[model samples]
Target: MKDSQPELLHLDSDEMTGYPNSPLPVLIYRQVLDTSNAEERADSFEAMFKRHGWPPAWRYHLYDFDHFHSTAHEALGIFRGQARARLGGPHGQETVLKAGDVLVLPAGVGHASVEADDDFCMVGAYPPGQEPEIERGDPAQLAAAQSRVATVALPENAPVGGPLAALWE
Candidate 1:
């Protein structure tokens, strides 16, 4: 597979809610897949993640509230329809994503689905051996979640492209 330059956006911790967002920037790869077939697109995305050592990709719709993964970084490849999402945290930025759009989210980065079409679907993957633990914005779990975020290691490579040295290194 060929490499593509993706747009990068960095988000900081949400001071008001005390949500520890990721230190690593979020990557947005647009038009990664040219085909319109949702199944073909999903297959290609899964294959790409496996090649990058981030396997066990799953298919589902994103949750509708602000949440983060404490233990694993994640990648979302949109295969069907379009949706608006809030990233970083409740106070984070909002962006629209469509079919063929890919998002690479570092562990602890908050994301939620703001709105979506009926056919909206996504393929999500995590780094090998890492299972994502869902953490909603709760003050009680703030300390533990922040600690986990701080210790989560960066993935060896980017989800779609081969390596992330240029952006992640």
Candidate 2:
């Protein structure tokens, strides 16, 4: 781990469109892993997440379309390659994420991959007992989504430990 503070990003809800972004700020921990070896990098991230109570769930690319999960927060550890991702929604914020970076998204925060290298991949995990349900920005589902998001529990520890864990608190 980096032994440093992570970059914090706060995104407000997009009420007009009905995407209920979280009250918690997004956390970006940069250069926190050794991406030189793909298999080892993935193993390291999985171990770290599991050790911290967040279980490693999947290894894949970020979806190409905009979506949010109202039932659980997410922790994505970039293991290989790089990409430009949109956070919040289609018109939200754009950011670049490379291997060795860890981006933590609270429940209801919209995200999608805008562009990515062919080799880009990530390890995604969630807090114990939290399973993610995909939700596109649909106004009709807004009421139920908002209720689920509001009740989603806060994570006790960050996927990346050390100083980064304090961000969740």
Top candidate by lDDT? 2
lDDT of 2 by residue, 1-169 (tens): 7645788888888866778888788898898896599879989999999998889999999999989999999999999999999999877899999999999999999999999999999999999989999889877777888899989888767888654435755
lDDT of 2: 0.88
For candidate 2, the 10 contiguous residues with the lowest summed lDDT are 160-169
Best by TM-score: 2
State the lDDT at 157 in candidate 1. Answer: 86
lDDT of 1: 0.85
Candidate 2 residues lying further than 4 Å off, grouped into runs, are 162-169
Write candidate 1's Cα lDDT for 1-169 as tens digits.
3238888889988767766787788899998887879999989888877888788468998889999998988999899999999998899899999989899988888999999998899999998778898887776677788899888777768888667767775
Query: Using alpha carbons, what is the TM-score of model 1?
Result: 0.93
